[model samples]
Target chain A: MATVALKSVKKSYGDINIIQGVDLDIQDREFVVFVGPSGCGKSTLLRMIAGLEEITAGELKIDGKVVNDVPPDARGLAMVFQSYALYPHMTVANNMGFALRLAGVPKAERDAKVKDAARILQLEPLLQRKPGQLSGGQRQRVAIGRAIVRQPKVFLFDEPLSNLDAALRVQMRIEIARLHSSLAATMIYVTHDQIEAMTMADRIVVLRSGKIEQVGTPLELYHYPANVFVAGFIGSPKMNLVPVKVQSAGADGITIVLPGGGTAMIPVQSSNAAAGSAATLGVRPENVAISADGPIAGEITVVEHLGGETLVYVNVGEGPFITVKAGGDSAANVGARVRLSLKTDEANVFDTNGAAMVPKVRKPLADLEKRGH
Target chain B: MASKAQKKIGLAVLGWVVALLVFFPLIWMALAAFKTEIDAVSSPPKVIFDPTLENFNAVFERVNYGNAVFNSIVESVGATLICLIFAAPAAYAMAFFPGRKTKDLLMWMLSTKMMPAVGVLVPMYLIFRSTGMLDTRTGLVIVYTLMNLPIVVWMLYSFFREVPKEILEAARMDGARPRQQLLLLLLPLSLPGVMSTALLSIIICWNEAFWSINLTASNAAPLTQLIASFSSPEGLFWAKLSAASLLAIAPILVFGWVTQRQLVRGLTFGAVK
Candidate 1:
């Protein structure tokens, strides 16, 4: 319904800055997720947009109007806190209708709105129950219902699924995604879970230490992280980064000596750093495969079997052991030597300053995000 | 197994013994309230005696206790109401909107209670005397309200802290301003703690002897001063004193008996994590 924008928004207490100059624009009906580790100012940024926290030194505009000084209630927004923040004394219906009641909406209209939200959240059966009487997932739904009933310009969620168990988290994640599509309202979600961001966000903003590292579609971030931090933070089982000595730079790519005395030509623009210099090679575990004739060889240190896939940790003698993803039925065990091959075009090279070197030609993956697989 | 049973029995016996020991004075007083003066003073301390209503009759005839009772009720109950009105908001600010100095401020508020009230007696007496409030219920109410404010605020602050900060933030997001947040949400949620603090304040105000004794002669004297007034030049009138003690404690005992559960829970609930 509305676009939210932050321009050079800074949050600081005395000299200790929290959100250090964040500038972003969220479009109408867009589901944007701010993803980062703890203490990364993601929640603070969400709160700043919700007007729960003041913009320290920058403009915050909602729907093209500067709302830097507007109180939270006046800002036309709602937030679902990690704890749900459900009123323990109120029934589910009352909890959902509270903002309406506070705004002096008539009882009939308030009840109708509450009923509508409850139906959407599948909380009709729980209308008469207090928050304490509900399960964790039910409480979470009620919290979302509370926010939804407000019908604010933008909905803010601060780690809403953090309290849910894994199975419930997945269920709730899909439900929330469904809610976003149905409502078609602008949403800003803050979470430390990369999987949640990747699954639900139209655009993901990766942040670290109060600064935005990169912002892109999830697949874009997955395939083309701008820096080492975004690459490391976006993937689970993280992208393996190994220190390598650059052998040569050419029109084709830069040839680098891999961690375990193997050589690979990474297809990225060199921007001309002299050969024999050190750089980092970035590779995802899924791209690293075990083959008898592969160039790099290392002993398997640990193996994690997840029913559908196995993760084999290999001690490659130079880096924090490179991990290789294998089939669930693979018989890779600790202490076995495995030769590894990589998808050369997919590999990335980072200079010593942790900036990913630009790829010469971008691979055009068609409708990567829309593909169910 | 036998030793466990013995230990259980031993604990029960010990508990009862301690209970009786603590209740001995009140039991003796209740007994003596029904005894004749001579019997009450008997060296053996009469456990059983011919019960008479003479001491109660004497108290009724000698003292016009209605005025004292009214004064006690008005002063204590008035101070408690005012205390609630003033203290709840202060506690809310301290608990929910805490600053870097909140802890220091709480400690400072509590520290005011550490200085003896007697230390400020002469100045307070002079101020009251000059202000024409020396023996008035208004004066005592004012003093009691100030006297109990720090503790009430402290109690209410702790109670308010037990509420999740997110609930208030939700209320704020829901468009409830500061006053509405306090009245609609916080007060209802912490009703038990608020009630316990009020009861404790009332009891403290009711039993306060030093202020009432020092500040009043007859016009605004409460049950405490009335009980003290029973002391005679001849000797302590044991039966009459006992009768007045029972009379003074009767209403408060009932008040406490009705709401003692809240008092216990509010105080001890937060003692642990």
Candidate 2:
């Protein structure tokens, strides 16, 4: 029954404010991830919830009771640190049973609980070995096993897999997803890796410069970013934002002139944008296609063949270099001229201030409120 | 290639020569300890002679050797244990939760050691006299503990700093209180450092001569005073002085030899991987 709530939480160090007025609600059994670039206050927010950092000017509630002044152990929460923080001197079994021992649990019951957690983490064989003797992945499992023995209402992971190799990270990612389902505990994870946020989060909170840029489910952030920052930050190969001029605005949509003398009327609300003003058009790499009669044309500067998919970097006049995700068998070569067709239904329009003009029609999967649970 | 090999052999020979030169005085003293007064002060020192136990017997017969040995043991060991009890927690706080002024505070504590012992000797004597602490084992223990506190704190602080803060935080999250964390986690992890710190402290307190000579009389006089007693102004009895010196240093030398490995290991800790 862990439902964590924060109201106007703020953290400051004298004149320097690390977290500025953050409000969030994490529901029970939901895997929420706070993600941003470095120094974006994501880890600070997680620590505040763990009762590690003080909430300077806000109320934090866990299970409908204010726990702002509670000590970390009294909050009924467990944390897995980035370094895995295992006691190097203790055996795996003792490390897992330390909290139970402190709670005055009998030795027989403590051993049973430790064995159960070790079996769940597949660490039964390594129970008697010290942390230094275990490999990195095994030590990681021991750290998680320690957390699991406590059986806290909430689990907080601060970049738990950031230390693993690539293949191990993927394997551990799947293992964590499995653990989430098996335990059915509310979890809040913090990471700078956007791909982890996209894959593992039931809801992603994107933070930048101590403030939340946006919060939504994975596909919603992918298909309907709130502004230019979110649009550029949340996708692979990045969304291509090309400068354009506003030609006209009417009931149908707003018409903008592209770089290569092409006009496209994207269906977006332009209430604050006047005709003939400057604007930006955003298109995902997957949404841009190469065709003979396409409106915009550019010469391919570089082609990256990634086994199953190829990315084509093109230059159209003096505008920003745009990327196109094409088939693996793309016949396009460097220095070859290609025409690009923008998918208007999938296009996003932004005014001069970089604020995304609201879309008139909703993307079905992008509306998380309307989705069936 | 031949020159490099010759150079290596030459350096080894030179090292042995320097070591023997440094140990010559001790060797001479040990030899004299087994000689009569005439043989000890011979014009050319006696290299080979009929060695006798006369000097050792005379030195022991003249002084309360057993009481001095016991006093030395009790004062040195007691001072070291008490110093560690106070220094460990102070060092833990300074290492783990260092405020902006921590460096300054450490430097100040070390600066107290830089002042010569004689500079404060008169004042210390007056205080001891007024407080009825002069010529007592407790008085000597207090002085020795204070004398060794700075170095003990500094060494323990550096060792404690080597432990990662994450481990302590993890202990806190695991519901271990501060005292338990110190007892169960930190002390065991830094056992080697703590052991070497204790060894160094014991060695320093055992060998302390200035305070032992100035503050103590018959009842609390340690081996240092015993050794000094043999050097009377009536005449220099070289053989008996040598025997007393040998007696004073034998126990510490054996202790040092037995624990040399741990001493070297602790001193050079964190230098390599």
Candidate 3:
């Protein structure tokens, strides 16, 4: 039960700045995930908060007290690294109880705590085995069990499931979500995979090049991203961002010319939204459909059939290639002519500065979840 | 099938030839140790002779050979422990928290072993004589410790490097202090390397001849000096020399043969595949 606040946190090595300046407030029991491309300093930010890396300049407060100078062990935080850095020489039971032993916890008490953590992770039978003796997934569980025995105020996971196979990754993801709900401890997870962020986090902090792009709930980020970067980063087959000319801009709507010489009026409110200027139209895969007389025409480049849905890649001339989510049994094949129609009300418009023009009104949570965008 | 069999037999023959060549000198020495002085030095070398243990009895009865053996064991073991005490912390620092000059510092430490030991003979003798440490086991221990320090540190540094850095970070995260990190994590993880290093240091210290022969007369004499004494003005008694040499080297030879595998592993600890 702790709130972590970073005020203008910055990390730089000599002249090269890694994390420029990050200011974020993490409330107690919030599952905040930092998602970004590789080299975006997401891991660095998590490390800084875990006290594993030094903050070049900033004030970090945890539980309403400054802890920038505190060592990791004294900061009341447990971190599970990408490699699951378990002590290779130690048995699973001893590995989990190591921190307790260091704190002078009595032998019986330490054993009970270890047993509890093992039971939670379902690692009771492997208690006496060393790390080398366990499988990769079991070792990963032991790493988490080690952290669980600490019972820290905050749990920091740095791409903890990245090394696992696909099936194990999915299983571990659900288990981690269950653990978060069961423990009700604040967790800061960092991953480049958007689905993990969308499925697990209460609030997702999108980062790019050492700066936070946006911080919002999954639905808010999906339905109303603050900018083009967030729009392009949040969903599965990323949102298609196409450069187009702004035909006209008004207080209630902005009309942008489409690639095939058609125009659609996007419902956004921007006081400074101008006409005869450059802008981008952001459309998610699910928000665009194939129609016989749709404005945008293109040839299907590829078709991916994912059982219930098929992602058809269409290359409309003079704009970005667009992916349209269609019914799996639809007769969309490579080289077929595809006409794409946008759901205009759900479409987003970005101005010359790449900032998303604010929506006229927020969508209801039920409506947003029902669309499953 | 015929060519493969021929190749295998040829390789086997070459391997035996190499092994026999290496073992010839030790075999000859062993044979001479059990022979009388006359049979030991006979022309064309006696291939067959009556053997006796009188030469060993004479070696013990004539000189204080027991003192030399005791001194050798104490000096070698003491120097090995002292060198380990000095090298562990140094190697730990160089391995985990390296700086810009770390590589240069490691190379400099290893380069000290390249220079000939005879080059420092005069200066070392002068210092030992002036300090009244010329004939003491303590002096030999200090010399042997310095002699073996570089190799010990180098081996340990490489061993420590092979251990993943995340393990140490895990210990640090688990509230282990630096001393505890070294004792609980590093010492156990690299026990084989450390054991090999200690064994090498003991062998080198036991077999060292230059400093022992030049600086010590009676009290600090080790096995090397005792073997050298067999060549005294007795007109080169081959049987007595061989018996003394065998006695002085038997323990270390057995130790080397037993631990040869670990030494090879230590030598090639981090070799790239």
Candidate 4:
């Protein structure tokens, strides 16, 4: 297994810049996922690392050796494409054994390696079948098996589960997570699916327009997003961003007025923000609670029932719709008047420039200091 | 529902009318070939003449039908093979590894076919005569190969284009070299298309009347030229000529029958995704 470092990598097509300068370090044996919406350069970054695409600028190094000029084969990496790019003409055994065969391994060794990989992927019964005969999930297994047999230092998966049905995707996602632990190889997975990034990645690299918006553990990004984009992207049901203007500034905190008329004071430490300036207040849908007596009132516009939980979309006065995740058993009817309250400690404050301001809680640091050295 | 049955009947009647119109000449020719020379030229056209093998005997004797048939088979098949040999690689390069001017180059190649064959007949004949290729089987094969090359390349190029580039890329990532990609991936994927194009090329070469008739006297004369020879100095030799014409078309008819589905499928391959 090898650590991969991309230093100031950038990509462009003529005048259109696809990926601006991006620098990231994927430590050895860590499962790093690059997640973003389509056209956000997540796949481009993975392709660049796989050496499938040419690097327009900067250096990429694998295991501390500069490898910007290396071809894909020489990069010591194997990629499982979104399409599962299995050779249609080859049987499962040959597909998995291709790299070893190409490396000139003898027949006995090749068969053994393929058989072992087949066992690992539960593909023994599929060894003789061509890729066309396999279902999507099975083809994906063969694609993964193909990568596994290569035994490369790094495994790159480019949205490998996107083509499967929901159940199969979940099953395969877990299988891949298990594979990562079993192989202990450095793996980089790219997907637009946030839940996959949250559940599988050791470090989730959130990219937007070719720049790394944030790079941290999944919870770190979930609890402490670096910007409004990451905040809006990382969470399920999306973060409700309400426009606000600073009302008063003091050492203790800043009071900001919401778009419709209400004011809420939030403690945040940021040098750039000032009183009488524009900022956005972000609250995740799940963090917003509906109460009988609450600070804000709105008309319930829609409610999305998702079995265990319900997402209530509400229009407060004149502001944009704010969504709140409520109990599934609670019948929150549309067009009903409701009062909502923000979970302050879980809320995110952002400047007009879309930079997230970290919430300043008073007790955590002091408690840590008091408990230990 | 009532009109639907009438519509079906109307369509069936119309279909039979077209079929008979097409089959009438062939039926008359078959009848005439069985008649004596006197009956063959009868004014009212005898439909119930006594059938005989006299015309067949006359044909085999008067013209070397066997040599012509053999030459047609050899030249057509040889030309088809030669066309395929050159077309496959040219199509491969054009479809996948295209250079900057490749589109223009393809257009230029196609434009060569657009030019009437007779427009270059004089030059081609002079070159063939000078080179002593005027009446040789090898010369006919070479000419036919050239004649069919453009269509062959065009067909194969389109077929190659239908194959997903990802398949080739997957092969490359699997460590297949260029030659292996061609032999292992492209050739197998495009088998149906190549077979159809080969069949079509052979049919075209077999039916090529102008070049075969103009260039060959006896030595390399194909079935088309053989059919032309049955036209005597008189204005018409309908019965004998029709027999030779039917003989010339029979092989191609059989070939078309065997691969008809594949041919239609291949021709329409590019019209869809």
Better candidate by lDDT, 1 or 2: 1
Model 1 residue B72 CA deviation (Å) reads 2.2
**Location of the lowest summed lDDT over 10 successive residues in candidate 1 chain A:** A364-373
Sorted on DockQ, best first, the list reads 1, 2, 3, 4
What residue pairs are clashing in model 4? none
lDDT of 3: 0.91
User: lDDT of model 1 at residue A228?
Assistant: 88
- The prediction achieving the highest DockQ against the true structure is 1
RMSD of each: 2.6, 2.3, 3.0, 3.9
Stretches > 4 Å off in candidate 2: A276-278, A366-373, B1-14, B270-273
Residue A314 lDDT in model 1? 92
Over A202-289, each residue of candidate 1 has an lDDT whose tens digit, in order, gives: 8899999999999888888888889889999998889988889999999889999987678999889996767999898889999999
- TM-score of every model versus the real structure: 0.94, 0.95, 0.93, 0.89
**Candidate 2, residues A141-193: lDDT per residue as tens digits?**
99999999999999999999999998999999999989998999999999988
Against the true structure, candidate 4 has what lDDT? Answer: 0.87
Candidate that beats the other on DockQ, 2 or 4, i.e. the better one: 2
CAPRI tier for the interface of model 2: medium
iRMSD value for model 4: 1.7
Find the 10 residues in a row with the least total lDDT in model 2 chain A.
A364-373
List, residue by residue over B1-273, the lDDT tens digit for candidate 4.
559889999999999999999989878877777778778899887888787777788788889988999999999999999998898889988898888899998899999998999998999999999999999999999999999999999999999997887667666666777777777778888888889899889888999999999999999999999989888687777777777787777888888899899888877877876
